[model samples]
Target chain A: MSVITREEVAHLARLSRLALADEELDHFAAQLDQIVGAVARVAEVATADIPPSSHALPLENVFRPDEVRPSLTPDQALSGAPAVEDDRFRVPRILGEEA
Target chain B: MSLIHESAAELGRLMAAGEVSAVEVAQAHLDRIAEVEPKVHAFLHVDPEAVLVQARAVDERRAAGEELGPLAGVPIAHKDVFTTVDMPTTAGSKILEGWRPPYDATVTRRLREAGLVILGKTNLDEFAMGSSTENSAYGPTHNPWDLSRIPGGSSGGASASVAAYQAPLSTGTDTGGSIRQPAAVTGIVGMKPTYGGSSRYGLIAFASSLDTPGPFARTVLDAALLHEAFSGHDPMDSTSIAKPVPPVVEAARQADVAGLRVGVVKEFGGEGYQPGVLARFREAVDLLESLGAKVVEVSCPSFEYALPAYYLIAPSECSSNLARFDAMRYGLRVGDDGTRSAEEVMALTRAAGFGPEVKRRIMLGTYALSSGYYDAYYGSAQKVRTLIARDFDAAFHQVDVLVSPTTPTTAFPIGERADDPMAMYLADLCTIPSNLAGNAAISVPCGLADEDGLPVGLQIMAPVLGDDRCYRVGAAVEKAFESRWGGPLLKEAPAL
Candidate 1:
């Protein structure tokens, strides 16, 4: 069976918030299937007895003092924003339907 | 010899002695870039005025009788993935095409503090995703050895800049073999420090768990100098190691391997490996033995699964790390025709902004981490990751360091493997296990392959916090080989 179908790829695109084109969907479906098939080998040796490693280091609860530190000014913080309004990021309507 | 052709250490010495000014060193490199960049395409951006300004500052500091760092007044080509306040940090992606970062990466800030003059930002794979710079949205960087071939990537520009003599030192980040593979093909030294040895704050993320910033230079000593200058504990990076940085510079200077035990990885040779690359690596091992080092064969059985494990784990982490690039914040945003919703605009912007390889990984990551599939894909991959780390742990107990050919082959012609993701990924086959295990690894140019006459790298792997061992062995190999080749391997590169 194909590891990934075109419909599944489109669903993944939507989940990833990427509006992939129709051609891209077909092409990616084929490539992703092959890659997924190859990587499936990982499951072959990942027995339940073996513990998973989320990170290379065994770090935990890294903390810093709760004191305030100097930070970017509002202007500096929003300098690279695609759109800004009143010292805040401006985006298209979030809740409203398209006009 | 031209100032541009001098090593970083040599340039620094000359500058400190007042024989050559920092401005002269910077200008010489700028002139070299101007002459060769059209063909090499090593740099994505160069501001001569800004470069000279920094160089002039260094000269003034020296004239005022202030003591400076060992690398004071030397010029460096910074990989574009590191955030730089003065220059655009593109990560070779169009999404952040002209985004001027408000902060410098810890590596960038430390280099500047060490008094190294920044020449400019060099090119890289988009977000350091692919094995070749072919994935760069800005266009690929050509290898200085053969313009038609790739300078192994995602750190291709950093390696190529040093190889071409446009800059004596450069910074690169290795998530897999991004730094070493490129350094191998371009005939330079690249070191991937033990994870957490260098801070990653302000570095554009790829796979946060696996990403590590490192150094590239023509000599082991120079690479070690840069490595020391930018490494150490940083509160800014939560994962940064709290211990003092290993004495790599001293180790490089020692350049002796007498009585040290070296292990040749049993799995890295034979089938699928190029005969010429294997031949060169074997010779390097022989040289180590002749230098009084004890050599043995060690097998890390789980290493065979490194590639598949790395592919899953990197993309799984990248899927989360790259989520910050949504259209609303900073970077390219499209499809907001005053009528579309924010969500629609974001989707359109992302679809247009990312390259094919980046999109493929994002989708794959999403699929792997999605509901009902996470356990089978991502969870299993993490288990294999544990096994890989255990393999390293077990091997380190028996050997001081493990050796292998850095990559499977020398530089392949550009565009040969562009459409084949698996083929491109194969370039990093020997270097991935270290990243998965967070061990220190260095790739030093061993010799030119017999078949193609291109450079092949001998990889030296050391245990965590044992980064100096790699340098000690590397410098010994470098000294021995330079004696045979008459000079650095890059000297043989065709003149631009």
Candidate 2:
């Protein structure tokens, strides 16, 4: 199997949204290559027509009754929050806003 | 009470009779931990003061003539994957380092109700993703037997702690053999309860469908005592079985193998297994026959593909289950340059939060589940899963239980498979099929490998929900074998 190429690592990093240090990229490339190569063996038999089985048990519709039950209060939910403001978890804005 | 090595049932008897105070039992384990932990590295955290507090509470309740739980005053460590209300549960990942859950997992709540004192969270693979505990963002834990070797993984820390006698009992979760493999390498007893037998409401998800929480201890009956305390129905987990918990403890005590139909899998006893492991497994099978149990060879043909299919399906579910760790809700976040797109920040946060192995799984999962690849990848893997299950059903019809080498080999040096990912994944071949089939399995130390003198695990597996059978037959086999070996394998483990 081909080793994970630098371009492939860069693409995967982009997909994973990781900002890899220049020094670490080479090491990760080798590790990712080995892992992907090992896992990629699934392709040999994973042909079309077989429905994927995500769960081992065959049971379906594992839903709880939609009864309104107790829930963690905002304080409890956010108790371990690193940053919070106005009863909401605070985070950097996703879409850039007007300064 | 200094005989903390006594089975949990024995300890409970003494505690109930007021022969030993819970505080004294807890203190002895605390002192034992102090002497052993630096060498074992089994624990990520140890709160002796908190342990004492819980033990004292158990003592007070017993003093007041109140009903106490079975494991009262027993000290146990939990794998970091189980969320605890009082202790920080990081799931052995840096992303959630020092993050404490607002509520305890069902297993933790059950442990508390049983009056067991929580020693602290033990180490594990990061997010329980890898086979060896080496993948933990925290430093790797060394095996107690050979300080330079591994104690097997994901539940490595829990197994190591028990093997090193830092704690008498501990809790571990198995997904792809985490509990069993670790116990095998560490020379302790570990079991994966039937799927949904133990609630997974609070276990951090790696592969949600496969994760099953169970117990690890020094002896079969101790594992039985711990399992009795933890296994039950939980409203919080949809998959939690509402049926009465099986009588595993009683079965262990019965320890009857007479007339028990034991099936030895044809596929598992083949090439790639260490010679010592093969010999030990053969001896175990022979012992069962001598004890009046009929041993027959059975075949699960589709199991050969189980490891490959599991790799795909586990990662696919993992990719989806772990998507919640995006920087927005919980866990760490990283951002540079105050101005950035929401999408950009999400990416940066994920990149920073996930370790290499986690990212690798996520990427592979994402790739598998991607629209075009789903049919070819995840789809076929699932069909193979059905085939694997069918193969198991066919075998179960012919035998009451199956046996194999828990792992292909005993413990190797820490870095042996670090760079060889395929080799690492192969270590779990014998154990993976049990998880894929959602059956109950246990790994008890059969003997030490002749070559390295490292521990080797003899695995016992049963049909889905055939948990009691595994314990029943396992206890009998262990009794017969340990007598010849002189004692439990871990008892000879070097004092750390």
TM-score of 1: 0.99
Q: Pick the candidate with the highest TM-score.
A: 1
* lDDT per residue as tens, model 2, B75-188: 898899988988998988878988879998999999998899999999988898777788888888889899888888889899888888778899999999999999998888
Listed for each candidate, the true contacts retained, as a fraction, are: 0.81, 0.51
Q: Is the docking of candidate 1 incorrect, acceptable, medium or high quality?
A: high
- Model 1: CA > 4 A from native: none
lDDT per residue as tens, model 1, B49-144: 999999999999999999999899999999999999999999999999999998889999999999999999999999999877999999999998
> What are the runs in model 2 whose C-alpha is more than 4 Å off?
A1-5, A22-52, A62-65, A97-99
lDDT of 1 by residue, A1-99 (tens): 997999999999999999998999999999999999999999999999999998898887789889999989998899899999999999988886543
TM-scores for the candidates: 0.99, 0.95
DockQ category of candidate 2 = medium
Question: Which candidate wins on DockQ?
Answer: 1
